[model samples]
Target: MKTIGQPPFYSSFFLATVIIALFLGISSFVTYQQTPWKAPASADAKKNPLASDAATIAAGKEVYVKECQSCHGKKGKGDGPSAATLDIPAGNFSTAATQGQSDGALFWKIEEGRKPMPSFKKKLTENQAWQTVVFIRTLK
Candidate 1:
């Protein structure tokens, strides 16, 4: 038995555990605060998204085939091989709700590129990006 002046072995162990728990809790809170959470693209998206004309869609397809296919897939399904190694998974482009997102939103995403996705603003002209938006409208 240890005197009150000196902590017992179990007291030291308990103190150490409490210190570790405190450190981990603080670290977790810091990490959570540092991570940015992006809100969904549309707060109130249209019930029926705009449908681009065939001519525009065709122009957009050309741009997509040239610029986006390698990562987004030939069919815009986000299953391209390059997508596998990407930090952020490529978006699936076939669903109506997804493809239905506004042209402005799509253009911004293409221009800005999310995290692991590199921005194409410097690589492709804005017109090309808008055309890609048009092509996206045609996907199922």
Candidate 2:
């Protein structure tokens, strides 16, 4: 039996409630993903100690393959094997949004990662992380 005052299956009020809930859910997801990934101003000022030469980039590539390729993709398009499973999509190095950030900012981010992306400080030496930045440049 139906309730005396409950919403019917297709009532406008019921539909509106469902739509609002859906919109809120989608908005929250977007907000979580679009949250800024910024480093401190001090980090932004820091320069890359390593050169952008072949050897530097090559060394970076090796590390990236082991540590990052699963998420950042083979060419740094953020389309790697595990990307689909992540709540936060991997960053694409080819885009201007990534390239626009300073090298120091990149290093800082690698050193102190936000949720989803792990902080490489413990896993990689400072030089290694810097080299990874150099390699990332080539992806653009």
Candidate 3:
């Protein structure tokens, strides 16, 4: 039994836990927001060799449906069933945040994913990845 003015022993522990949780949450949000997912300058320079013709777009759409629709949504709006489960928001392909990126940057990102987005480098060939970029362009 402590004095009325003083908090109990467990109170200190509870306060510490709350403070740590808040710190971690804030840090995580700030970290995710602060960093831009831009690829290397060299990657930006790389060009998409495949034409954006109907056949290429069609192939890309097929791949997107099979691979990305689970997380990126059927319309590429980042509202897929799995999107809710991720700590980070699945990219909305229609948004400028994604559409503004060059084809090469997008392709590199697909090749080298961040914490939540898995790298398709092993799963998809270079051509497929490039085609994915092309398909993403038509997302709007």
C-alpha local distance difference test of each model: 0.73, 0.92, 0.89
Per-candidate TM vs. native?
Answer: 0.62, 0.78, 0.80
Question: Considering only N, C-alpha and C atoms within 3 Å, which residue pairs clash in candidate 1?
Answer: none
Of 1 and 2, the candidate ranking higher by lDDT = 2
lDDT of candidate 1 over 44-101, digit per residue (tens): 2422233577776787888888778878898888877788877555767887656666
Whole-structure CA lDDT of model 2: 0.92
In TM-score terms, candidate 1 sits at 0.62
Which has the better lDDT: candidate 2, or candidate 3? 2
Please tell me which model should have the higher TM-score, number 2 or number 3.
Answer: 3
Q: Candidate 3: what lDDT?
A: 0.89
Worst 10 residues of 3 by lDDT: 29-38
When 1 and 2 are scored with TM-score, the better candidate is 2
Superposed model 2: Cα runs more than 4 Å off? 1-31
Measured on C-alpha atoms, candidate 1 has an lDDT of: 0.73
Clashes of each: 0, 0, 0
